[model samples]
Target: MEIPNDSPVNPEQVTSAQERGNPADMAQSGDFNNSNSKKKKAGAEAGTSRGNKSFSIKLAPATNLWTTQKNGAVKLRMEETCCGGVSPLTVAQMFQETVNQCGDHVAIGFKQTNQWETLTFAEYYGECRKAAKSFLKLGLERFHGVGILGFNSPEWLIANVGAVLAGGLAVGIYATNTPEACKYVAQHCEANILVVENAHQLKKILEIQNQLPHLKAIIQYKFALEVHQPNIYMWKAFMKIGEKIPDAKLDEIMDSQMANQCCTLIYTSGTTGIPKAVMLSQDNLTWTANTAGKMVDIKRAGRERVVSFLPMSHVAAQMMDIWIPMKFGAATYFADPDALKGSLVNTLKEVRPTAFLGVPRVWEKIEEKMKETSAESSTLKRKIAIWAKGIGLQAGYNNMYGNTSVPCGFALANSLVFKKVRVLLGLDNCTKYFTGAAPITKDTLEFFLSLGIPIFELYGMSESTGPHTVSQKNYFRITSCGKTMEGCKTKVDKPDELGTGEICFWGRNIFMGYLNMDEQTQEAIDKVGWLHSGDLGKFDEDDFLYITGRIKELIITAGGENIAPIPIEDSVKSKLPIISNAMLIGDKRKFLSMLLTLKCYTDDETGAPLDALAPASVVFCHKHECPATFVSEVLQKNDPLFQKAIQDGIDTVNRRATSNAQKVQKWIILEKDFSIIGGELGPTMKLRRGIVLKMYKDIIESLYVD
Candidate 1:
């Protein structure tokens, strides 16, 4: 039960210390490890290069930002006039600027005891500094990580910024991760302190605490600990630990930080293998927040408000919820933990944020819910909605195609139908709606457009910070990811006759190299500075970027015909209203086959797919004269009516195919729809193709069995 708080861990020891026990622990236990210190010194002399070209403006000399001082770790300036140019500033400095400008403005809001509570910018900043002191007091090593595993909350933000202010990296662990996955991230980052939401998340850490050699303590931020362990502490107690620590000590660590030094570690989904830690520097964060805000025209100070519900572990969520709000002095309201399951709409209505960001799945769910509700409306109301939607769709297309002429009856339609719908969904005040993290079908986009909601698309990955290209409300094509952000540049490498190739990114927002991953980092960033994104895309005459597919996700049939799966999948979903998920599977096979799942009810608590059909799917079945109420019943009866409907829809899609190889030759309905808990989707609700192909291997094999 002894707690090891005697020595500070070295960031250079992350890779080695995970395999071998903590070097500091060995030294304290009379097993002095001289070899570790030698290795650390060797790494320092070798130096880490992010391949960033020299900049005239360097913030400060790299000191103890990492155990091995890295060169080119202070360069945040690039020769670009985008977003009125960029500057070098640590996270601490950026946040302080906001506090100075809007000291009395509300920075964070959360519901407590069925009422709202708020925190001012200065008060929020003060709380973060207190957390930073506690981290330092708990022997948080410079450049070591503070792994936070929790839902989006004020405590999460405080711990994240506090870690950076204390000269450590802020690592957000997905709340849905397993114990083994949690161990990998914590061990990979050499985390000194762990923060969890409640007993459930705490159990994950307890199960793998032994494997995490550098984890010093575990703090539960949500509820009181029923049973206290040696190094376990409550939120209040943890915050008080560094009260006696001097302000000068925390300020000194902040002063030593550099803008280009890595301040955050975002882990990839690990669909292929172990998740890689994406190292985002202070400049990558601060610069992107300021510049992207400008690009989107994010309202300043109290004029902006956003509901924080998306998983903050993802770069998109972190940028939208934490960094952007800090830069603009906007208010962020924390949604309930079950926001993604079903309660999100209630939160949205109450908050009525000025801006909102939803992944493709989130928007799709909202679309489905609206359809279900509309089905139950009176005949006259439905007719009126239909009329309004037609006008709205026409007006939307007119605006998008650069026609300033608004369609006739547009104002009447908006006032009668669109206005009421927005108010009911709590989006009445929202001026901008963004969708990203996956490719959204044109069906979903047009559905929202018909309802007077233009959802902008964002394109980028963890390597590019968050967004490289963004589809703004003013200038956006129907399905394109829009133009690049002001200073960011995109190049399509090795384009074919159609100008389709891999997308590469270049800008100040480009991330520092992955943590402890040299070869992978080199592969990602070339000999020059461009970060080669392994995504296939093309640019139109207007310079708008369109993502075709991922390099790894592309399927090559046995006939040597290459096909992208997204378009085919989207076509199937659009043609068949009952189908919730569609995945094409014909790699190295004679012809393309598909795996489809019918829309079904899901457990509200766990998000587990249920056997009963959803309302929309049930309605579809009734319309087709099929009395089936569950997915199993449809298959058990071999319902020819339902089967023929699906077949006819697939036939329509096949007719539109460019070649025979592109057609879906066969398909089978899955018993359950894909869900995050089912291991078929990532946290952001993006389809996990590899996992799906493996999970249903026998079923897929049966389809192609001669």
Candidate 2:
């Protein structure tokens, strides 16, 4: 799909910007030779070639959009080709195309008044346009921000698209962020408007309103306003503000949009330091959505459905829940605000979604819940399930190993057990199961596989527009992240003997750059224009990517041996079935140690870890002839039997360790499990290494003491 040649900016003017010695402009225009240092230019060419040699398509020329970075020095590094089969389109253009094709199809489903409420594609787009006009009437400026802090609701999406439609950047603030974090993002993005889901989120904004000088107004999309103030409006009242604004004015802004210009700001949930705003362009979102949808064979007939419950502030969630669905005209059902607490499965059953995505923690919870239910079955039923699972496991392995033949009795097993299991979990219709944003153990993968559900893993960061490599149907490995996308390129830079090195990416999916962070941007995208992912990984012979570790997370012992924590932690967990979390310590100490948290019951409403043991843990304890109910109870009593069992598991893990430095020499069990509320995990349930270290500093010091 060729872009029209009727661009308003003259090619001559863009050439002038490159000649003005602006480094960013030179990078975008592919004028590497014009650099002062010839060595730098040569390296850039070599790096570019190494990154894009696998792809054959010719890239479209950079347009005026490439030079339109008003707030920062961030610029897109020109690639040899656009994302394989996608045209460079703005968010508004993409939405319109879907609306034209599926006007009457259901676009969104939300629960209201104890019933599912529906919005057609045409109606969804119409509401967005109305919201856009209101944004203009409320003084949203070009290149400024419109911060939306809330759950995944129709209003959140509408406000997001509306901000872009009105020529402003859409900034999604995490609903879990504190008032200070909200202020940092709002102030950094120069937000002109803030949209909250309800009074709870509104209260946060109100506390920091004085610090956000650029914020002009606030809109509460849910619940009636209990406190009235100037420039604060309810959802209906806010939508009416732009009634006097002309459609032609909004249309002009839409027409002026370029795919390469920034439209969204995704702030990273940093493990340490302040969050940096990741500047994503219109092309980045649209190209990734189109190419990724094609990679996974997403249907465009409006027959696809998905459930949105993950935090929209995350790149993966936004791409899967909002961008991809919008691209394919799929209906998205908004799960309850407390969906992660326990309600997501109910929505999944009601929606019968065709595709589903979850973080590793979410999938792990599902696995545990299924195991709990299975334990209650009668002897005859248990025998039948065991028999069926054997066939399912073989069939699952057959597919993973590229064996097309189905195992004998597979059909019978599916009819008897797998089908029933899927129905019980509300996933009878789900064809794709995705897990990402954190490492998932092989045990969990196999557990789901035994139930005839294969969870494909995706690998990427916020900088890559969610996924750079995707494991999909007919192209997946059990423990490896699959091949790079069609139009993208991945380079394992400076590989050692094992071929593991930093995973670098080059493609249209790369972000424009961090908003207003020139130094950090330069550190990320090198002179060769490849975005350094900071991840350590190597590809197999089949080009399947295996993530070994991250540069920042690698532990270096006193003996100078480097070790990756994930593999060791995974090993410990696999050996100890009762362990919920295991963190490897001893980065600069004499020997490695670990911090372990036992599996325990969690609050169904708040998701906090309760004192009682989980069902699986309870069963494990009973089998060992040591009955324990709470984690605190075991620690308080210092149960010798339980301690021996845990030590036995650690010894088993040590037997598999490669060297003395890699083995855990000491260990301690935490009183509670790691969780989002405990401040040990991020919003997506990813481990926060820095936070964990600070919180348990004394415990760690004690382990190292003589």
Candidate 3:
């Protein structure tokens, strides 16, 4: 079925039966219509001054309307029930409330010295109090930013909350960032104090410390006692420094914090250029945590457990692992950094968290592992697995389309195969498994759904407090990022003929703006408070949003035909298991071309060879094993058989293209795959198109030379 891309269903268009006694119905039935018209008229009259103010043609209620303003901007105000009840003003208040309610409950858990360690809410709060006092003693002032560079740990969370309690801002530095990148963030935020996890992070700071005159001290969380340097305080000694100050002093600092004040500076992952510091206020954090929790129906008071492993510098990690847990008294287990590469599967099995948030790559790896494991079973077992999966897919589809009843043989299939798969994936107890940070292929989404695991795909950026829209339980679309959250407004600005346009937003969760970058900030948020997201997207009749591509990344051919490369790239990669990455090229050329990278056969960490094979070969072999010669020959770029496999994959993907312009006309398979260390991919695995284009300019030109 071809998906329709338009604004959400209008309240006026809704059937009477669906709208009966609904708030949306009440909004559309009265003077509200006239008021809306008047507002549009007023906006139109002042359109000249407003500049391109075009009011939306549909006039419905606030709950179901996408109202057009005089400035020609379309706006959809979400329903109010989406918003959560009264939330605390600041992180300090949230901490105090959680401590009072669940002081003895485990707040943070981690593995240390081959055994698990934990800290209770009361213990964590007490640590924060001491840290806040220490910061005060170190001359930290209101709104002064403190930089934390490390992996996820109890100390990282404590220092972050402590900074806020001390009336200061907490700035997280990505652990994978280069030393120069680290210096830029610390200098840009003017961090007064910097905290490092160990000598590795501390060394990065020391290399550039001379350039940071504002940095007064450096604290090491781990291996603190072994280090000796001027102005370098150990974690234990740092907390002791705060003990010298009276408890009343720390309380006074916490009391002075305001809801609207900025509490943290989260830098954007620098995929395109230098990272920009996003200032999220106390209100933004609390509101998002409370509101998103309600929308997803997350259990509170230590009932919910989640694995914390994603980079804390990312907003999603902060929102899920820190804010949501603190707000709802959910226990969070910090996954060990060392075990992340080799022991994640065992960790997930052991923890069996109720909620899991993973990027698309993580899910892809899990899916691959499942395939490998299942392939090792007997022929009969494999057939049963396949048969069970088909049944599960039908059940999942029924649920997605709002059919509550299960298929006749679904229970048997579940008990026989699906249940074991779920157990193996460590999702037996999981209620919510979310995938975000980048676009997930439809193939990946459906594969999990077929196993009775609904992996919800959400949409948001650092500017929107992590996620403003998410696919709800049993209410979702195949490729959509779901509907707007409560108290949030979204619109497609000046949509094209196909109804695709830049997605704009307005909500309390919108950021305070980039720190010390006023001109750029003004360019993002307009005078009326709407944040102009650079990404192009479309909305269906059901209000489900489908992100197409970035506005700047759109390719306009010489024939004047516009193309979105993401869907095409995703389609190509999904069809070819042997192809690791694909990038479309034809911005100002006659036709489309592609630059593809092949998959690696060796394990990234262990240096062991894997049984990676092309889809065609996999189907023929039936067994998981590939011939030794096949693996060796495929690694060579000039191998004819390997080239044939790549060409066949491209042909399959081209068959699905809606238009001739979307098909790849020419292509070249690169000798290497993109990696974060190579600067071709970002931390979240998003392609740095500009960088890739620049790096492969010669190769790209070669395809068009003919």
Best by TM-score: 1
Roughly what TM-score does model 2 have, to 2 decimal places?
Answer: 0.72
- Ranking of all predicted structures according to lDDT, beginning with the best and ending with the worst: 1, 2, 3
Task: Give the worst 10-residue stretch by lDDT in candidate 3.
Answer: 64-73
lDDT of 1 at 528: 67
Instruction: List, residue by residue over 578-673, the lDDT tens digit for candidate 3.
Output: 667889998656579999875655458744334464454444323323232343444553555556666787898877653465678998866566
lDDT of 1 at 636: 86
List, residue by residue over 1-706, the lDDT tens digit for candidate 1.
Answer: 1111221111121122212333233312211112344533422221111112233333655432221222236244375484636667678778877776676677777664444555566657767877898898888998898999989888899899999999898999988777877888889899999999888999989999998899998888876576579898877678778878877777678777877788898887664345788888888898899888888889887788899998888899999999999999888888998997899988877778889999876887798889999999999999999999998999889888888797888889999999988888888888889987777779889999998899998888888889889887788988999899988789999999999999999888888777777777888888667789888999999999998867777675543344678888999999999999999998756678999999999999999999999998999999888999999987887788888999999999988664566789999998889999999999999999989989999999999786
C-alpha RMSD by candidate, in order: 16.5, 17.9, 19.5
Q: What overall lDDT goes with each candidate model? A: 0.79, 0.78, 0.71
TM-scores for all candidates: the values are 0.73, 0.72, 0.70
Runs with alpha carbons beyond 4 Å of true place in candidate 3: 1-88, 224-227, 554-706
Q: Candidate 1: which pairs clash? A: none
How many residue pairs clash in model 2?
2
Winner by TM-score between candidate 3 and candidate 2 = 2
Candidate 2 RMSD to the correct structure: 17.9
**How do the residues 181-222 of candidate 2 rate in per-residue lDDT, one tens digit apiece?**
788899999999999988898999999999999999998887
